[model samples]
Structure formats: C-alpha cells, structure tokens
Target: MTRVVLALDSFKGSITASAAAEAVRDGWLSQRAGDDVVLRPMADGGEGTLDAFAAAIAGARRRPVTVTGPDDAATDAAWLLLPDGTGVVELSSTSGIEVLGGQLRPWDAGTVGFGEAIAAALAGGAQRLVLGIGSSASTDGGVGALTALGARFADADGAPVAPGLRGVASAASVDLAGLRALPPGGALVLSDVSNPLCGPRGAAAVFGPQKGLDAAGVVAADAALARLAALVADAAGPAHPGPATPGAGAAGGTGFALLAWGAALVPGSAEVAELIGLDAAVAGADLVITGEGSYDDQSAAGKVPAFVAQAAAAAGVATALVAGRIAADADVSAFTAARSLTDLAGSAEASLADPARWLRAAGTALSRTV
Candidate 1:
C-alpha cells in the first residue's frame, strides 16, 4: 500500500476511534512497514466528538471544567477549544446515560453540566459553539441547560422549577430576562437522529423507554415536553421554530433547545468530517478503512462508517470495514472488504472482553489480505 487512511469510529464501551486507529496502524505496519498510515478518529457528534477534533486539529486544547452531573452531583468534564475558536461541547461527556453507572435517573437526569461546560468555553473566549447532542440521560426538553444559560423555568406559582423533568412538568412560564445572548459567531447543533420533539415519533415516546421510562413514565414525560413546548412557543417568539423538526428530539430535546436559541442543525457525521478535512484525506489515500462497534441497519443512516465509505467511494478510493459484529442486513456491498472482531476472535464474549486484542488480530489479517 502506498498510503492507507484509518478512520474508525468509537467502539462504544470499548476503545476510542483514535486508539483503534493506532492499534490498526501498528498491526498493519508490523506486516507492511513500507506503507504510510494516516489516522483520523471519527464520531457522529457523540461522546468521542472531542477526541475526534483533538486528533484532527493542531493546537486544539482540551479545556477541563467541573460541572454538575445529570444527578445533580459534581463531575469532571472537558470540551474542546479548536484553533479557530470553535468550542465543541459534547452532551455525552457531562449529561449522558453512562454517567449514571447503570442506574436510571429517568426524569431526574438533566443537562446543567453540559451548559456549565459550554459556559466555561464561552468564558474562555470561544468565537462559536458547536454542540454535539447525543447519549443524553434526561427528557427535560433542555430547560435545565437553558436555565444555566440564564433563562428561568418557573412553575405556576412563580417558584423556580426543580431540575430534570420535574421542572419541565411544573413549568408554567419562561423568563428570558437574564438569558445570555449568543456569541457573535453563533452556535451549531450536531445530531444524527432525526426524531421530532413530540408525538409517537417524538423524544419522550421514542427515547424515554431507553432511558428507563415505563409506559406511564413515557406518557408523563411526553406531556411535560408538550407543556415545555408551549412555554417555548410563547416565550421563544418566532412561532417556536423547530419543535417538530428532525433532530429536535436529540439528546432528550436538547436539540430543540439549541434550535430555539437560534442554532443551525446539521448532520453530525458530515459536519464533523468536513471540519476535520476527511474528504481531502480520502482524496489522497490509496485505501480507506472505517468501522464501528456494530454495523447494522443504523449504520446506513448517516453513521460514521457509512459516511466515510461514501466519501471514499466518491473519491474513487477502495474502502474496508472492521467491526465487533456485522448484521446480515448491513449494506456493506460497496466496501472492498469487511472484517469482524467476533469471527477474528472466535467469539462475541472474547471480542467484548478484549476488543483491542481482537481488533489488532483483525488488523493483521487485513494487512495480509490487502
């Protein structure tokens, strides 16, 4: 190989995109030392988003900020400050479900931490904001985050609403008197999922179950979001913008909040890819490799691997995929080759137990084949 590009997405509970790329590079070079390897870690605006930016950009600093977690507890979180003054805030870092450690907060989890980190980035002089909204733990319609930014969610009695969905349910009026103005360069929302904010395909009805809500819980949360929507419409002016828009349901309605705040919504994978110069890299590469934790029907829906494969194909470059598992329905016919950790490691348990080891095994096998 004259040149090989390794652009892998994160392995969920396992290795990061960058780590997997490095492991693959090490394995590939062990067999073909003459080849040049370029690493491009990728994410679909989710948890590993900051890592992707840090890996691709020179002088992108990881700014650490202490913030409140979903459970109202203090936690350590960090956001990326790109060289061009873009503040990249990832929801999963501070307000994601994993922060609960397998426990369910349901209506109790909130995005105050996410807002605090963004506030820190803004304070540090971010020219623009790029919010990656995914892996959220709450269904507060982003009231908590907006509150941290200066809007107040008050109940019918004029008392400040409590955190999480409790606040959402009690919300009767919104106060934007003290809400901070957007930065001069504005904000952008990054999201892959396109569920709307209310109804059968809405945030609460579709995502509530995954966050531990039962049937009744889902209904109540949906009602609260509806109430919040009304409040947003009355207070937000301009006819409530994106309440029904695709991706408005992201991060448990945090995307809706960003939209209400005048942020532009864009496909997370494509936006991140452009910012990281993925198209240029693919144009120059002899071969391209991409992967994820699982390659299923969802992979075709703007996931990192699919997006990377599309980019590579557009550039007339050969592409391959590696994953922990690949579904029969996964449409990978466009790729030159595909490998899985399960087949390479001989078992699912083995692959899960040690993904890097299995990934490296697959990488070595891949090097010989290519």
Candidate 2:
C-alpha cells in the first residue's frame, strides 16, 4: 500500500488545478487501487488561486461582487473568505487580461474591479487579506484600483483624471486620506515577479508588452508609473520604498499600491503552500507528484512544482513531474520521473485540446513505472 501524493497546479487555459488533480487521481487509482492517493491542488497566485484555496481550506466561502473590469466593462467576480478570517482575493479573476475576451485595450485597461473585490472582502468582516496580484490586464500604476479604494487621483485643477494609463499620465496629485484602513491583521501581497515599478527591468518594460503595450506605449507607461510613484511619495511623506522594491511592479503596480496600504510582500507559492499545510502532506507520503502548465527554467523560480519538489526532498520522498510541456532546457534532475502531456499526446494541440485525458494518461504511466 504505497502512499502517493499529487500536487498539481492549474494548466492555465486548459484545466483547473482541482480537476487536474482528480483526473490524475482517477487514473492512478485505476492502475493501483490499493495505493493511498491524496489530491492537493496547488497554485502560485495566478488564475487558479481561488480554486486552490477553495479545495484545500475548510469553511472557505466565495463572496461575489460586481465591478469595473479591465476594459471598463461590468464584471462579476468573487473573493474567498476563510474560516480564520483571511480574505483571499485573486486579481486574475477580476482584472486579468483574460477578461478582455481576446481583445486588447492596452491604453485603457485598468484594475478597478480588483480593488472593489478587496474592498468587498474587507467589508464582509475579513480580518486579514491575501491578495494574489497576477495576470493583470493593465499598466496604470495601479491607480485604477487605488481609485476604487477611496484614494483620489486628480489633475492640477482637482478634477479626476481619465481612466487607465491615459489618466495616470496626466495625474498631478493623489489623496490617500480617504483610503480604507488595513484590516486588523494587515494584508499580504503575493506575486511571482520581482521587478521594480519602473526602468529597464521594471513592470512597464518587462510585462507591458504581454498586456498589449507597444514599444512606445511601454516608454510612456514607465514614465507615468514614475510620476505616480513620485506623487505617492509626496502624499505618504517619503520613506516609502515601494517603487523600487522587488515585486512592486506586480500586476501592473498593484503591489506598489498595496505596499503603500501597508501590505507585506511574499512569494506566492511558498505562502500558499504553508497555508495549505503542504509540508505535512508531503512528509507522510511515500511518493509525490507535482506539475504545472509548463515546466521550464522559470519553473524553478518559486513556482508550485519546484516548491512541492523541495518539500518532498526535505522529507526524503521521491518526487515525479508532470507538465503540459517540458521545455528542452528545463532541468528535471529533481524529479525521479518527468512526463509531459504534450509528449504523451504527440502534439501540443492535442494535449491542450484535451488536457484532462492526457493528464490521466500521464498519471497511469507514472503508476506503471512505480
């Protein structure tokens, strides 16, 4: 009776983490019904952060709210409230690029919806906040979100600026006096990025293009972020190290705004893992399997699979890997058996078209090897 633990993250647009775990579990059980299999869905503060919490935490309630989306359209989103009074808000579900429906509004997309969700969570009696700032749709220095939280951004004449980067570029002053206070337990910012708010390695330069910003737009947005950071410094009375702080550029400057609101930055996967008690789960397992949408050099950089493998290694448990696609350059030395859904399906399109089926096949193959 072998104890095998499955900790897999969402396959991005393919499948949810919980569903992937169940599919793999089913296949593993089909091959070895006597083995003890545990399903532990994982996420790194991205599209499936809420799902991960929903599956792992008991008494987690989904609180729904409607707000302005990236394209300035009405969006319905939900936040998670845990039994321990922590409000988990994922930016991807509210203001992520996916909400644009394949349309690109680089100049006008904003994050007002993300902030509204956080506000809703706080108003729902949450004592703490765990904000997952990933998959953002805009690069407005997070001013749009700040605006929804009662922070006013105005021009030289005291009139509200335009929405999105257009408005951020012309903003002359900021008022945080009306901004909501932090919860009793404060807020924690989760992100996989470490870029600052501006300059070469910053948000606008590194991530702006992915959100549809052109080369010229990236330059303009970087300047606007600098301008906003300056305004924030003036309003907060200096000593505000948010602009240049690592991860400050996350979710298009949402991290910087949250930092101004007194939130501490932490690695997303590690924090989520701790929240889900992954260490204990891996420690008792005879074998562990973990994976993500893509396994590459970046996967080792605080991603879910790497985090799980590290925990399993600490417990002296053998670990296997499964991924949608394993890049040629990816170092899979830590995994005893590495399998790729793309390879199993013989084509990337086939694997993505039916991820669950390939995931089950991967699971069965791993069970056979074990």
Give me the candidate number with maximum lDDT: 2
What are the per-residue Cα lDDT tens digits for candidate 2 across 165-237? 8889899999988989999999998886777999997888988987889999999999999999999988877
| Tens digits of per-residue lDDT for model 1, 1-370 | 4799998988876788888888888888889899989888888887688887787789999899889999888989898898889999998888888788778888789998888888888899999999888778899899888888888889989999998987898899987667777888999888867788999988898789878899999999998898888788778887557589888888889989877777888889998798778898889999999999888865775678988999999999999999999988888897889999988888888998999888887778888897
Clashing pairs in 1: none
List CA RMSD, all candidates.
Answer: 2.5, 2.4
Name the TM-score of candidate 2: 0.90
Clash list (residue pairs), candidate 2? none
Off by over 4 Å in 1: 327-336, 346-349, 368-370
Estimate TM-scores for all models. 0.89, 0.90
Candidate 1 residue 127 Cα shift, in angstroms, is 2.6
